[model samples]
Target: MSKTLIVYGSTTGNTESVSDDIAKILEKNGHSVEIQDAADISVDGLADQFDTVLLGCSTWGEDEIELQDDFIPLFENLEQAALKGKKVAVFGCGDSSYEYFCGAVDVIEEKAGELGAVLLGESLKIDGDPEPEEVSAWTESIMTKM
Candidate 1:
């Protein structure tokens, strides 16, 4: 079984709800999974655990970083070269009418790429009210790759 980590930052709990669903599916598949809050995590603390990382967040105003207040500092503290070769994926919740749907996922994916982490699975861009089937499919696809 693959060891997986799901880190999420949600202001209104939408992203957290999604992460919970993903974690449940992964655990049901017999994979060891840990769900964490991005706000409380530190790069140093995550240095040596798990092989797969799933980041979830909501899109903030003006297409800016959703959980920038938390993730920004932690992300900046990491050594770019140190994160090379890591495997990661991103999923975000946003309102499609906001003009920047899933903008948080965009930022997460870009940063993960820059850190040299191999992108795994699709970058899930769930609408304001994401579809269960879609989220299930996303979870299934990631599990297959894992």
Candidate 2:
């Protein structure tokens, strides 16, 4: 079984809820899963010892893309996370009304790829409130990749 880590930054708890949902799905599939709040975790070597790393951060701002406040630090310091060759998946919640809907997920996905992380699946971007069924389906897709 793979050891997976899910780290998320949520303002209204939507992203955290999604993270928990993904963790449950992974656990049910016989993988060991650890979920962490981005505010409480350091980015240094964040992907170490994990077979898969899942990153979630809600998007803020109107005209521009702004990662959730708690995720800003982690995203800025992602280079130190040792993501090279690590399997990575990204998800996030945002408002489609915004110019950059779920933009945080895009940025994270790009960074993970730039850092040499192997993307496990297409990113999951939920507009407004997150739905459990959608998240579950995305997790299942990732499981197949694993």
Highest TM-score scorer: 2
lDDT of 1 by residue, 1-146 (tens): 68888878788888888999999888898989898887887667463577788888887776454543555655566453245676788898888877777777887788788877888867999887767888999989877777
Clashing pairs in 2: none
The stretch of ten residues in a row with the least summed lDDT in candidate 2 is: 42-51
RMSD of each: 2.2, 0.6
Number of colliding residue pairs in model 2: 0
TM-score, every prediction: 0.88, 0.98
| lDDT (tens digit, per residue) of candidate 2 on 6-109 | 99999999999999999888888899999999999988899898999999999999978999999999999999998999999999999999999999999999
C-alpha displacement of 121 in model 1, angstroms?
2.8
The runs of at least 3 residues in candidate 1 whose Cα sits more than 4 Å from the true structure, single-residue gaps closed, are 45-47, 63-68, 78-82
Instruction: State the displacement of the C-alpha of residue 55, model 1, in Å, after optimal TM-score superposition.
Output: 0.5
